[model samples]
Target: MASEYVLRIPLDRHVITTQRSLAAVLEDIRRVLHDSAPRSALQGHLVAAGHQVRLIIDRPEATDELVRCLPDAGAYCPATVLVQAAGDGACLAYDSVASAISPYQDEEALAVAELFDAEVLSLLRRVAEPAPGESGQ
Candidate 1:
């Protein structure tokens, strides 16, 4: 089987009540990523399964850093974010950055990918979790 990197987060009602719609969640994710890495690019937005939205992010800056260590590693430039409304509330998923770069097995590439993974994962978690004393809209 082909290798894969995926993160799936189950949503809580408070998050759903705050973010109202998938579009809002997407916007929140986009905003968080933008804040995290302004240089990275948001490449596309897509619809899936009727009620789901996906965001495609191309981090040339991050890839550029990786390429310095392994020039042939340009294929994994863009990453994806998927959000779907479900019976519980909502689910957000994405490919794992480490899994994406692990094929190279290069120490430098793995290190960079690990850092990228941490940053993006943190961003997604922040997007899904509401702040203290703040009601979502």
Candidate 2:
């Protein structure tokens, strides 16, 4: 699998999350997931952000570990992230909840964020060799 994506979101006890996306692709996806999936006690808000989804955390130290992994890009793709108080968490204000998010960004961080964003994006690559009985030149 190609490795070049990360899902970094911070969590806190109280977070106000609002978001807009660089591209329009996840709005529909968030609507469907939110409308159907059963809410978990641990989950806060999994809402839509233009074409992406907003993942807001409401826990302690949730962002500490995550911030260490990601670069401080202020408001960039993957998230228009915001870190509040020291104990406060982060806001991945764009989840691309519809299209899908690339999970692997680096060797240290694997495609683990797929679990958090709850979506998967396929790596672009061509498969060598032909399938059995398939045409070959």
- Once model 2 is optimally superposed onto the true structure by TM-score, how far is the C-alpha of residue 121 displaced, in angstroms? 13
What is the total number of backbone clashes in candidate 2? Answer: 5
Index of the highest-TM-score prediction: 1
What lDDT does the true structure give each of the candidates?
Answer: 0.60, 0.29
* TM-score for each of the candidates: 0.64, 0.24
Candidate 1 lDDT over residue span 16-100, tens digit each: 2224345556667656555544556433444455666766655667778878887755655466666776543456776666676
The clash numbers for all candidates, in the given order, read 3, 5
- Best candidate per lDDT, number? 1
The residue pairs in collision within model 1 are 5-96, 18-136, 18-137
Model 2: per-residue Cα lDDT at residue 135 = 38
